[model samples]
Target: MEQILETLLFASDEPLTLARLREILTPGTSEPRDDGQDSVAVEIKQALAAIRARYSREDSPVVILEVAEGYQFATNPRYAAWIKKLFKDRTSFRLSQAALETLAIISYRQPITRAEIEEIRGVEVIAALETLLEKNLVRVSGRKETVGRPILYATTPEFLRQFGLRSLQDLPVVDENASQGEEAAPFIPDQGAQNPMAPPATDHQNN
Candidate 1:
């Protein structure tokens, strides 16, 4: 069953849920009793915990972590410095000021349309948006219901993982110097938008 879970993790492109693991382990099984479902969920949790422990051993090169309500295997953070140095020149991409601002807009006001973003930034972000999309930091969450169906953008989990955020709320608040005493940037959705997405916008910013 551990092998099964490992295989599922390797094959899954997205986070595999406990219910998903249960389904895979007990194919064609139907709802029997409440007790049965609870028992299975407990088993899966225990199995996942064991797997986590097993991979967290001192010599393990990789470790599994839960993020964005899902589990993924990643290299241990302790080794990140060396890993970065090894690939530093090859992956030495830096965010431009425009790109940074565009990403900030999306991180705060997603699932926001391009028009809405431009309205707030007071400048067209077409090129910066493209760059962010290519970097896998921003993604199209969906299209707005408005006329012309503008595509809404949101930050990806890769954004969170790269930024060392556990979730959107972990994003720091941008204030004072960053926005020049302007309205603290929008960190959540407008009424009727139903988009609960927002990320930290650090208050003490160097950039």
Candidate 2:
């Protein structure tokens, strides 16, 4: 079972949650009720711990990490220099400047409407939102309890994993005395003065 879990974690591109692991590993089984008792969740936890410990050896080249409440294997940071040279195409995985700005807004003022995001950025975000959606970094959390019940957007677990953040609380702190008490600067792109996540450009790539 431990080995199976480890393999799944290695193969999965996303974090594997405890409930998800339990469902796949011990479906239909009753959950352990008593504290310190044996259960599928407990077993999975212990298995993950063992794998993490094993990879923590000084000679290990990779490490298992629990990010966004799921387990995944990551290259040991010590080998970052070699990995960067080996992964030359990694730049394509990064969000464009526009997408980064919109994502930052969503991350901080989550469950926000498109209107609110645009207001913060002072620019339309249709293109940025689409890119973020296609990447699974943002999700439609729910509808706001406002007059029109506008759809609310929020960052997903994938966002946390991508950013190497544990949770929203891990977001960089802002100075309380800053202007509007906002973060020092938004993720404005270099060409933000001209085009900001322009939808035509993003869509034209598919044509």
Candidate 3:
């Protein structure tokens, strides 16, 4: 079960939630019995533990992490500097701090108006919003039912794919301070490190 779970999580681009894991582990059940489901949950928990322990070994290049309420493997952060060197000159565009902050705001507060986003972020967000749209992370979902009928923005599937999220429900609970005054986000290859989808970055910033 540990090997199976490890393979599934490692192969998935998005996070796999507990329910989703259960579905994949046990297919075609109209209503799983409570006792059976409980046992299955325990098995998955144990497997996850073993998998985490195995990847924590010193020789491993990646480690599994719970992000967006699901598990995905990430390169160990301690090796980021060295890893950056390998793709430093490639065609990649790292989202700027402002872009990240705007993205975080939009991620948590989806179907939000640009006005509301600016209010929360306390700055003009046109450029950041444009950058996010260009990256295919944010999209105009609909028009708000307000005086101006402002265009609303929500995260796209690409956002989930890039961030390893199963769904909006999987977003990490945000404290007020963290939401408003968040700092620069560390770079994670929006696309795989080996294949950058954007043009080459001269200043290592996407925005």
Clashes of 1: 3
Which of the predicted structures, 1 or 3, would earn the higher lDDT when compared with the native?
A: 3
Task: Write the candidate numbers in order of decreasing TM-score.
Answer: 2, 3, 1
**Predicted candidate 1 versus true structure: per-residue lDDT over 1-207, tens digit per residue:** 677777888777666656567777887666423364577767777787677666654335555655554566666554556677678778666999999999988987889998998998899999999999998999999999989998999999878755545578866576636645566645343111121231222222222
Give a tens-digit lDDT track for model 3, residues 1-207.
887888898889877776678789998644433464577766787788766565554335566666555667787554666667888887665899999999999998888999999999889999999999999999999999999999999998778757755567656665656766676444333321222332232333232
Q: Which residue pairs collide, candidate 1?
A: 171-200, 172-200, 172-201
lDDT of 2 by residue, 92-205 (tens): 477889999999889889989999999988999999999999999999999999899999999999898877655677677656467764656432222211222222322111
Best by TM-score: 2
Report, for every candidate in turn, its global Cα lDDT versus the true structure: 0.69, 0.74, 0.73
How far off is model 2, as Cα RMSD?
11.7
Q: Which stretches of model 2 miss by more than 4 angstroms?
A: 31-39, 90-92, 96-98, 142-149, 166-207
Whole-model lDDT, model 2: 0.74
